[model samples]
Target: MPQLPEDMVLPEGFVPSQAPQPPAEPRDSATVALVRDTDGGPEVFLLRRVLGMAFAGGMTVFPGGGVDKRDADTSVAWAGPTPAWWARAFGCSAELARALVCAAVRETFEEAGVLLAGPDADSVVADATPYADARQELVERKLSLAEFLTEAGLVLRADLLRPLGNWVTPPEEPRRYDTRFFLAALPTGQRADGSTTEADHAAWQRPQDAIADWAARRSGLMPPTWVTLSQLAEHRSVRELLAAERQITKITPRVVRRNGNLHVALPGDADYPEAS
Candidate 1:
């Protein structure tokens, strides 16, 4: 089990899945994380949630959020592994896992405009221009990820998502995420331009530098953001990092804290915890 955090308070009205529900629609959320190798080392993309928003408002976060209902639809083409594989990894039904991956890809595009799915330039799905417009519509709820893939003849590229961590909010928190943060190198031909809707500002910083900025109070980062950055700081290179990832057979979300400060433990580590 991941260790726990001490005090984690996001903006109000953003309740955790643990919050009281009327015996319906329990436990629904997921997250996608993109960690890249930069001059500052492994820098993870961080987005600052819009202040006064529904959830985690003003908190700096990885590009992810609650899974959409459209995530479970399976009519779309899959670029890689089947939903069944992701299902086991998430401890959920295959349908749910498929949906989570779809949300991850979709949210990554919606929030950051970074397209992680699709074929390499030389592959058949050569043009990404069409998907750009489709992505805009998907964000507008005019289409689902599955429908977009089906219509565009694209694939979900499930293999592109690497199992990172599974985090459930503390039972006491009002809003929680059974979030599975997946890791991926920035895909070719895609840019990490963050949208202003969810984030006030976005940046790809050296994980260490970001942490330093947080510690120095230069950049506003919440505990979760700090913890994730600390973990990313350990990887010196993308190749050396992804090479280590192949050895990752299991990921258990543990919250680590020292002197009341909280953090999340990486898959191959037991260093920090995220929740109480």
Candidate 2:
């Protein structure tokens, strides 16, 4: 986590340009932690965001983004839990729930070159390279998931996703995202590549090793990513991890001023539990 700028020095003759505005409304978003099993353990696919991006710039994060309006298209071929069941799991309307799931699948494919779709619900694509043209179109928003799947005669494998948690950006941040985190095992025979424009690099790393790198200051990670990775580092196998159920809770940290110092406090901070 980056240090809070509570002790920055001000210029001698600095003048404020404008009054600070209230935090923006949190936009609905979805993130997918793509994991794969290795002889050593489970490793997750991670992307290092480019420095020029607006949010989480230069930070290592899971593949995800804001929900697209087209993501809610009910006409898209879907196989697995119904929108109503997803609504119950995610604590949102059926429409928004549909969009969130679609965003998760779409963003994962866009960022990691892994598509959780296939000819039917029970199957997954053996190779995703054939969809390279559609992937580009999806990235450019020239084609929606519905359009691509419809044309390709594929169905969205909604069962591949497992609900993890929900987090809202702190109220003080200029950009806020009401993000829902999801976990999915990487599809068989499909490889993830680091070709997205948003990321400078992407790699598969064991959760524990990623945490060690962050601790050693070899990479940057936001609080959510760090905390999630810590939680994931405990699992011994991807199968066991995916089989487990998650208790999703909304965590929005509060900015607390204590003894002339500033801190972002989580709900259970009294014990100051070590994340890893």
Per-candidate clashes come to 22, 0
Candidate 1: C-alpha lDDT: 0.65
153 in model 2: Cα distance from truth in Å? 0.5
TM-score of 1: 0.77
Prediction RMSDs, each to the true structure = 5.3, 5.2
Which candidate achieves the best TM-score against the true structure?
2
Query: All candidates' TM-scores?
Result: 0.77, 0.89
After superposing candidate 2 on the true structure, give the runs of residues whose Cα lies further than 4 Å from its correct spot: 1-21, 257-262, 270-276
- 90-206: candidate 1 lDDT, tens digit per residue: 677888888888888888878877765564322333335556788789778998888777776666677667766665554344444556767777776666778647788898877
Instruction: Compute the lDDT of residue 131 as modeled in candidate 2.
Output: 96
Each model's lDDT: 0.65, 0.85
